[model samples]
Target: MQDLTKEPRLSKKQYLVVASMLFGLFFGAGNLIFPLHLGQIAGHNWLPAALGFLVTAVVLPLLSVLAISAVHAEGVYDVGRPLGRWFALLFMVLIHFTIGPLFGTPRTATVSFTTGVAPLLPKSWETGGLLLFSALFFLAAFLLSYKERKITSAVGKVLNPVFLVLLFFLFFVAYSHALGNPNAQAATTAYRNGGMSFFNGFLQGYNTMDALAGLAFGVTVVTAVRGLGLKREGSVAKVTAKAGVMATGAIGVVYLFLIVLGSMSVSHFKPSAEGGTAFNQVVTYYFGTAGHALLATLLTVTCLTTAVGLVAAFAQDFHKHFPVLSYVQWLALMAFASFLTANFGLETIIAWSTPMLMFLYPFCMVLILLSVTAHWFGRDPVVYTLTVGFTTIPAVLDMVASFPAVVSQSSVGVALTHFRDSFLPFASLGMGWVVPAVVGLVLGLGFHFASQRRQAGAATSNDVQPDNAD
Candidate 1:
């Protein structure tokens, strides 16, 4: 095997480009639309809401990159290996599915079409239009990914700057003239006030799906850093951390601007079922006919780049796990799956995927937190096991409680859902897992410390007394 540690060093300019690529990769799909909706709905509470959204959406995803660096593991499963091999494999597969065919990948195509292409077509052509658009979109992503080695240069040097320029232009225009009253609604019942908006925002961040996707993206980032010629593990980690920070900062700025736009528009505009629709309204309100063309171009490129990244990540990881399938074969499979699922449309995808996200997000959050902070407990496997295992109890219940009406209506499901909601702290807020996770962390640490003390005492006794007598 080649020694990655001995790779050449990247110039500052090269490193910055990598950072740009990371931002663009994470900045697609829901990245653009979610916060605008939050802003529109949050109104006077936008500050608290944005803060909460940032914690999970921006903070956690950056931490994920650091977590990858902390472990120096090549893939996400390395973080999960402490739980045992089989469980790790299960987790890797589920996250890959979530970030791939089942949700994330398909979303890229759907969002691209809905936000970028759909407006150009008549309502009568919505279904066929999506099918045709997805076919072309996924095909382009597949072609770009076929030469995955160039992804960093291609995206960082090319696509990312275009994305940034257009987005910044939108922000400039938005700031130049306020579209609606700066003061608007307080919040919806879910976010009755500023303080409560934190948890609501946290849960809503799950919809961004970046936290899950970000873990998978770590490999892409690491590989890019390595490609920059940084050979030593520490050097690679250092660069990855720096790039993570830069990317996080960029994403934060983007989210803040978009959220502000969303918040200000609340007084004059109602949020559409899809936030993209609201985006169009705001853009057109200012730029008129030109905004439509600019938006379609912006959204299409953003979504295409994200799809390329997801497809590459999935195919590369899948090939590693199942070498019998070539990378191209895996890419072909992923692209086909994305093409098929995207035709189902954006709203339907969100509807089916949200329940799954509710189940898996808590698990991802615990994993990211533990992996990044593992050094505090000396990287003990028991601590990882305990924290991750205990979290599942509430996560599963939250799943049951939040399950779409289809499954929740079953008698047994209904009874269990009630038990969870009635018994768990924060269950009503869909955060039942938080308290249990903390308890699990405490207990795991307690066990670890006691065991260490017992071992130390036994060693002391042996040292003090017995060789001669024996």
Candidate 2:
């Protein structure tokens, strides 16, 4: 058997191809809505807000890609090796569930129900229609998935182009009309917070979880590329990278455009709406009923596709790790679980996702950083554990602070919040962990290198011939 630990050489072209698939997997309509809302809030400050959003949206996602590439990770689990095998498995499972039924799937159902299904139904029929429609939607997705990845990939290719065109129509119409309007008001608080807009945007971007998900999805991209006959590791990496860059580039443009549209709407629309509602209002104002219908349909279909893809991807990963579990069983289990969660709706899903991201993103980010710097750190497990542990502590504390309601009742939660309040990092926005994590990495590396030098000196002393003469 080939040693799994040995390095695999994927060509740059292959990397680009893998990258593209990864990008496609990462971007979705749900990712589009929030920033637009932010823009509406930020108004003139949209630039800084956009920058912050881009940090999580663009830079963080890119960092995830770089992290996976650095370690030549086979999957997200592999990247989390610093945390240990059981921890890796737990992390993977958490990611899959979060992006699948518990968070993303439910959001898909809710978004579609509100935007697509609800419009057609009377208010009384809305709830029933939502449940029914989501069931049918996920069922169709599961059936389509049975056709295999190539078919799925082909559909993705077609859907992506169509989705892009639809999005173009969306932005173009909004931009033209908003610009033509005789008068428009600027957004409230567009340029306040003393330049915290970027930071806020970054936090908002984290909600996408695309970068975190990418580490998991990398295996999918690699597997798909390999099936396409680019067996060489280096070639695969190159192709994936190209594809990834293109895909994310597309997503970035779309996100910025949507944010601009949101900013423009602040002049005419209410600021109370979140991401999905903001999108609906923009569509209604620009295109009227017909435009709303089109937007809803597109979002529903996209979310359905995303849900199917995620469930299928998770099942595939699970089977690989646990050979005893048949693929079909895993798929069915994930689909059923997702179906149950999809009933919760988009708003609720997003609400609950925050603390989870708080708890997990730091670890995910540290993994990337460590993997990239593995060479400098001597690939030592000790260094990995130290950086990750130190970084994760504050992250965990922040997670507790952010979810006061959830944690307030539990002993663990109570303890965490009590301690966290005293910590400067926890008192800040959910990101008190970033600075300390970086410091920990630096300190840990310093100690490691010093110890290594001391060991070297001792070894040299023992080997020296002068000892025999004495």
Candidate 3:
């Protein structure tokens, strides 16, 4: 058997490959459109708004990856293992569902179709087009993800670079042509104030869902690192962190570029309802008829890479925990489910996903923060439980409040919304959980230190008694 005690590491080229794979996994449908949309809304204030977006979009996701590495977690399950087995299992299931077939996976197909292909079809044929397109999309994803070991090479070496080259080409052409004056555009009503613009941008970043993906993608990165001959856990984690930085840094730069692109586009076109629409408009304006084909290819390639990563991560983790189904079986189930969900259309998928994102983002943020800081508190269960417990109430309330207007307008929803707004600080801003999470952290730490002091005092008494008896 090979000695696992020896420290091993990937060379610079291997690290770059791993980083590229990670970039492909995280930079999916939402990553493309969200920044573009934000740019239009923030307009002249795009800088602060973009910075805010970066906090949740770029910074939080990067922290999550490092958090996994910091704790030497094997996967999402291990990230939550400090809380307990059942909680860990539950956390893992929820995360996989959110980022897998339910929201993230289906979204890839719908987004690619709506942004890239739908414009080419007649209005009446849009529905049929989506159904056919998503079917093909998921099939392609399934094939790509069938072999787990080859994912790194397939995505990192091939699809990622192709997508980047296409995307950068679009950027270069737009800049060369002087699409618009971003500075001249006025901020929208929602983003009129700089502080609110920042907060709105921060909240907008939640839509990218990259932080959740970071947790799910941790295993993939770690596995790739291990395959590179890193046998020691610490070495694997160290290299994983490096790869994450490289990947997210690239993602951040892309987000800024897209945001700037969006801001510039406003000079020539009106604000679009969605970023996908904005992207389509911009591409059409610059490339004319050929842009349609280019965008279709670009989006399909981008979303396909992400879909493969999500499906693979979901299957690998689920099969590890629940072995009743083989990895291939789980993969098939996810693809089918995602295909069905995609038919619901891009708008519908996004509408339903909002509430779930609102609910889950808080929990995800808290968990990531705790995991990163676990060393300071020695990864105490008391801290984890109490902190999560405090976060749950607000998260649930936020979910209720964020539900579609049909539900939010109901009596029950009104009551809960009222209660949340009245009692929870920052509830109006959709960040009601922030203050409570902080309070929970402080209280949990207090209890932990108190318990430690009592234990130390009892040990001292026991020592004194032994001396007295002697």
- Alpha-carbon TM-score of each model against the true structure: 0.96, 0.88, 0.97
Model 2, span 1-470: residue lDDT tens = 97644544555554544444454467665676777788777776787788888877876677666666677676778887776899889888887777776876566667767766587678999768878987887777677556445533633555445655787877777776773221243546534653777667777888887766777676666667666666656666665556666667767887888787787777677764677778777777777888668877778666665665566677677888986877667777777777777676665677687888888888877887787678787777777777877887788787776664756558888887767667655345567787778777877888889899999999988888475544
Q: Write the per-residue lDDT of candidate 1 for residues 54-108, one digit (tens) a residue.
A: 9989998898888888988666788788888888888889988888998888998
Among all candidates shown, the one with the greatest TM-score: 3
Cα lDDT tens digits, model 3, 1-470, are: 97657765567998899999999999999999999999998999999999999999999999999999999987889889989999999999998998887789999999999889988999999999999999999998989889887888889999999999999999899889877788889889999989999999999999999999999988777777777778778888888899899999999999999999999999888888999989999999998989999999999999999998899989889999999999999999999999999988878888888899999999999999999999999999999988999999999999998889998889999999999999999999999999999999999999999999999999999877755544
Between prediction 1 and prediction 2, the one with superior TM-score is: 1
How many clashing residue pairs appear in each of the predictions shown? 7, 42, 0
Candidate 3 residue pairs that clash: none
Candidate 1 local lDDT, residue 348: 80
Q: CA shift at 343, candidate 3, in angstroms? A: 0.5
Cα-based lDDT at residue 401, candidate 2: 64
Best by lDDT: 3
- Cα lDDT computed for each candidate against the true fold: 0.84, 0.70, 0.91
Question: What is the full ranking by TM-score, best candidate first?
Answer: 3, 1, 2
Q: Distance (Å) between predicted and true CA of 317, model 3?
A: 1.0
